[model samples]
Target: MGQLQLEEELGKGNYGTVKRVLHKPTNVYMAMKEIRLELDEAKLNGIIMELDILHRAAAPEIVDFYGAFFIESCVYYCMEHMDAGSMDKLEAEGVPEDVLGRIAGAMVRGLKFLKDEMQIIHRDVKPTNVLVNTKGQVKLCDFGVSGQLEKSLAKTNIGCQSYMAPERIKGESTGNLGTYTVSSDVWSLGLAMIEMGLGHYPYPPETYANVFAQLTAIVHGDAPELPEERFSESARDFVSRCLHKLPGSRATYAQLLSHPYLVEDRNRDVDMVGWVKRALESRAEKQVQQQRERNQQVLEQQQQGYQP
Candidate 1:
């Protein structure tokens, strides 16, 4: 590794900024995430934890952490560069059904790697944390809010508000969050799928006050009304299973990969669902209008007969 020529700023976060850099020696592009370690000791610890976990995870779906160094109080981490950028970018461009299926498969594989293989719980599994490459391959990123579970029951609030599992939001662990389990990640993954397809947070609130109120409701009430039929049937079912309110009811990553919707050609199945739903909705509206028109005609006929 030689001098890295900084080209452009990729992104910025609360604790750090990621910049696109070209290594002069290899002429390869990489992302350099620079974190100011001295800003807050607690924040620094979180970054360090993320770095350590990423290093421990050499799985294919996880972006490789190449190297790291400290310049004064600033910590810089060099990781594999994704040319295609984040899932948010893909969602903005509108992904096709096949591409969405591929993405879903990749994410489930990543979750399997994290949960079964590494035993690391990725508390945050949102779309923004998933990166895509030129080949449309998806990689999981951003471990700042992630934590390794040691017990079977965890009673702490973590992860992004929108992606947080219902139990986690309540800061009450009715399930096994103490140990690194895939259930919590599955819930977040479902939210990620919804966000990617919808182009916004599924449970977005009008204001911050509304957000808290909604989270509280989510913790105690049923899951939000997910716009499932808006996507393919397979995709809808996959996400629906992931969003199951009970953690144990959610599909495991491996189970998701083998799901009929993910592995098979579901063009006919999904399309039929889409077409039929729209037709039924339209027919219902037409029937209502026709009933009103029939009533009006009857009223006019009665009035005309009386007048004659």
Candidate 2:
């Protein structure tokens, strides 16, 4: 523990919390996820699945793994550190369609690799799990919930509820309940693309009183689309393809990669490094401004002899 110098806490989830850590001997920086080994099936599955995939999968679209070991009740594993962080932290304003298309292309390629080579389905495919680096690299991370296909179907719902497809939400009332297909991942991809496009969740979570209401809207409501005025026709069509109500109608990874929306920008010379740099700078400046305001308020309160 002492040799692994801890840095800022990246994020935490149901299974584990990821931290930026440095190995003193080699001075290597990596993202280490410290997961508590609870004697439960879900947690056990997550730990085993993540470690298995991370160790075997080697692609530009996937995060690189260093190693993993168990210490006491927690299992700590190291992997790539995405310097620019995840898509959730990126600036949404002025993020044009081309940039988004590039991200989608990379993600699709990553998902394709998992599907074709590893026979795995990433149950969770949200913005937070898609990591981006300052070098213009966008790779998929967090594979704990990923599942191997058995006859092209995984019968479990171990993913984010808000990003679940209508079939996933229903569970099994429709006969295929608990049965999941790759199309379910497509639905999640559409939602993630919108979140990156709009800087927030596509679904109106606030309007709904509860999770069920939000899910009901997802199941029964019309599919979401990017505003015509804000996005191009190709973009709108592409999202529609992924968010189809019927899983069979949804575009597969190969089809989506061939879609004009993604292919058009695949080779375009987008200054991703510059875009990510600017976004990080903007976030840092905003944080500084917020801190300044807070300090000023504190100083004023002290001068006025305010008591709490």
Off by over 4 Å in 2: 1-3, 40-46, 146-161, 172-177, 296-308
Clash numbers, per candidate: 2, 2
The candidate that achieves the highest TM-score relative to the unseen native structure: 2
Compose the digit string of candidate 2's lDDT tens values, residues 1-308: 76789999988866579999998888988899887765566756666766877799999999998888888777788899998898877845645687888898989999999999888788778887899888999999876443322112133332233678888777543556455778999999998888788777778667788766777788899988777888899998998899998889999999998999887886689988988898899889888999999999999989889665
Q: After superposition, how far is residue 40 of candidate 2 from its true place, in Å?
A: 4.9
**So what's the TM-score on candidate 2?**
0.88
For each candidate in turn, the TM-score is 0.72, 0.88
lDDT of each: 0.68, 0.80
In candidate 2, the residue pairs with backbone N, CA or C atoms under 3 Å apart (3 or more residues apart, or in different chains) clash, namely 171-177, 172-177
lDDT of 2 at 110: 94
Local accuracy of candidate 1 as per-residue lDDT tens digits, 1-308? 24889989988865579999988888878899886654466766666676777788887788877777778888788888986677764464244455567677777878788777666677768777788665445688865333432122232322234677876654434454343346878888888777776666666665436555767666666664335456667667877898888888988776887788677633323342343244345545767999999999999999999994
Query: Clashes in candidate 2: how many?
Result: 2
